[model samples]
Target: MTQIAYFEPSYTAHNARDWEIRGSYKYPSLLGDLHTMAKITLLMPTLPPETDPHRIMLETNYDVRFVALDTLDDAGDANIESLVEDYATAIANLEPDIVSTLNGRMIGHNFALARAAKAVGKDFVYRIAGNDIATQIAVREAAGRPVTGTAYLATLIAQERYAAEVARSVIVMGGTERERAAGRVADPSKIHICRRGVDQSHFTPAANASKSCNRILFVGRNSAEKGIDLIEGAADMLAKTRPEIEFTVAGDFDPRTEGNRHYLGFHGYADLPTLYQDHDALLLPARSEGFPQVVMEAMSCGLPAILSKSLFEHDFGAGDGVTLIDRDVRSIVDAISSWHDDDSLFAKVRSEAIGQAKEHFDATENGEHYHTILLGQGK
Candidate 1:
């Protein structure tokens, strides 16, 4: 049996203070499936380290073992050198055939894993997310959020570049990410495109199915890259022309949003399916993304999407169940109006969205494919 070590920086939710009770709705379908196929050891970094890292919780998969390492500060930030040393120690203990990392960015823990793998002469697999350098610059410009320090950002960028240079293979979340990684890596042949998947069984359509005809939803982090300001502008425009159309921003969002739309505070994984069912469509005008998991979950619930043209182009190709538009107030307003005006188009989009989810977003299939690739069967 092949042993694979998967490393993620943090598993804590946005609002949750404790780690044990934190929700993991995203992992069960994919990670659970992986556990049955291969021996997966989930390695995590913890602040104020948990005493019993080996204790199996009821919510965690029995087959997958959990391991936690200590970070330097209360913020759970581990230096790259220390992280490399820690990962090397874990590799010595786990003796994994393949070392894989989910977030392949500079500050991401996986970068350290990549370095450790290189040091130990082990195969490294990097899973690239949507947050590339361009997206980081866009987020900094749009949101005014600090990009770590200038020096730190540079270090992180170099780390990611080194990872791409040395990784035996790389898994990109979407075509856009693949293109971005290809621009940096020496061997483009090592890159593969893999979209994010959802648990269709958990995100089923509503049984009663009494959703309003013109209710629109935006579910994501309240970051500038997620186009929260654009969502507010669109809501304002719709409130004037299409007063009957209601807009809601679920999940973590700014409560101080200047609009007449409903802002439901952050909803965890357990409560997201019902939240998706409550809305008629998903309106996401993100500046960057690697196949937003929320979109797959919403699609699994038979909800159509109105996404930014960039996101649509990068992930869902044309003829998919998506209404693409520019990330602007007018474009969002027109897309909503069009969805409301055409009955046949709306029906087709919804039906196709569900069909796409069933066909492409199956979590088990995603896990199986990753298992094959990690085992060197597909390479």
Candidate 2:
């Protein structure tokens, strides 16, 4: 029946606190397919460890199960030795036919599953998000620079080779064309581009927006890669040009930190969509992204964007629907000005943005592709 154990660090959002889960599960169209996958077993690290009926029931995939292990932080300098030891015992106990890890080696619990996959001679299907793979690329690129020269490039090449050498197969969600290109030779046909999908139903333009105020929203963790500082600079410029406009930063937010950013904090799904609806536009200046879920979600709410040139590339085109900037405050300010001035143009852009989200980032389609691959019916 093409039985496969879906290995993520954890099923609960609390444990594997990353962007993938929300993108995968909460996706309206995608969740249904995920629920129907053949014998979908969720193998995550559990400390009090016996598989429970409630856990399986909660996942809504009756075939699901859990396995607990010693907590190891994934962000640390970890190796395969200890991981193999932890999961070899677990896999022997569960006896799954195949193992597929979403976050791949970058996550701690999956490290264990991957090790077990190797020792038991089972298929190990690894999946990686945009950041981790791109980080490796950036490293290679930096090494290729004049200062790093031949020696550094040679060393990084070996490391890259080592990467391509391991893993039975890999799945990558390409946020950019560059990412797609890099994955081509990573492992022959083993490395496939599993595109990300977005939801259109919930993100459509709000009917109650007539009562909403003029505001812009930026949703993400407060990090360097998110371009929070750049947004603040742009907001600073907006403050001068249109004193009536307000900017809000949502998620991993601190009021004291973002100079003038009004902190809305991390809101649940019910509330977040409203924020997007209420806001006039979405601002995302990502230093890097793997088809950012936030962009799709915002677009779904009919909020046009002012994103980095790095973001609005390819099928994700940069039209008036997007205000593409070179990480400059003035450019961001200009986008805001233009959107504010023209009502018809703004509406057109907003409509296009929603259409694009429906076409591209729907998780339901992505999940169907996932099922196809695991079931040997590759999309």
Candidate 3:
């Protein structure tokens, strides 16, 4: 039995249930570990006392364990003198074969677990996300800022440098063209990209049998980076031409920066199925992505997606369920117009997208990938 402790920002999220295992069985975290000759232990640092690994471990057939490092909200908590000691005790209790974080917010827990692993000469890997990477690069490149101004960035950089570089594997999302050209993802063997996974059951689309509401759904944060301008421009164009189509912008927005658009605030991950069901198509012309989870989610619901060309040009783009379009307003409107005019084309692509979602975004498949990485399985 191997114990893997996960450090995360929060436990009760409105996102994926596989990490927390709330509604039903989620295949991302444990099912694969159980399959590939290991007992998986998942420790959520931000969860409550009762749901710790010791108790949560018994709830499933996956042979998994869960533990909480702390209930602290802040990421930069420096006073770990006692927290580290408590973590040490938890590690001893679980007696894991190896330790890893599912996602990279638990740097504090990962660091503590790393120290404990070092004491016994065990190996561990600290995973980080794109936001962390962006922050790190920004800090290094920030002009005239004091050294202490970017302490968080400096701290993570130091940790990576000091720790056995070979022992730590940064599980990043697969690189973009720019990143690949820059050697950000030079060796595939070293870096594992656990990109956008799907909650298939929830995100599958439904038929709009009764009627005449042509709905276009836009999900994701309304930010400049998310390409809100592109969507809005296309929506405006659609409004002028059809005048009957209704466009919705679901999810949160920053009013100060990206300006105002129709906003539905944030919807829980569970609500996505109906959200997609209610919409005719999903519009995500985001400028950048490690992997776009929303596009996959929209596809799983049997909903056709008009994704950004930047994403659809990737290695697996041709097979996935996406109507690739440029960042231009005219392109998106034209693409949607094609989907609207040609029923058979929409039907064929819609079915293909659902198939791709089942095959690629399946949690069981993703969990297996993680399992192999944990066990030192083949590339």
Ranking by TM-score: 1, 2, 3
The number of clashing residue pairs in each candidate reads: 0, 10, 11
Q: Residues 1-379, candidate 2, lDDT per residue (tens digit)?
A: 5566655454443543343343334322333455455555555554212343334343544444445544443423354456666567656666766777544344334445555677887776656555443444444454563523455445444433443345565566654533553554544666666655555565577885532225778998766567777788888877776776788888877554344468866676556677788788888877766656677788877787888786556435655367777877778778777877777777778777777766666666766775566555653
For model 1 the local lDDT of residue 181 reads 83
RMSD (CA, Å), candidate 1 to true, equals 3.7
Could you give candidate 3's per-residue lDDT for residues 122-169 as a string of tens digits? 556645444443433434444434444477666765554333243445
- Whichever of 2 and 3 has more TM-score, that candidate is 2
lDDT of 1 at 79: 65
* Model 1 bad stretches (over 4 Å): 10-23, 47-60, 73-78, 102-108, 132-135, 142-155, 207-213, 254-259
Model 2 global lDDT (CA atoms, 0 to 1) = 0.61
Determine the backbone clash count of candidate 3.
11
Span of ten consecutive residues with least summed lDDT in model 2: 22-31
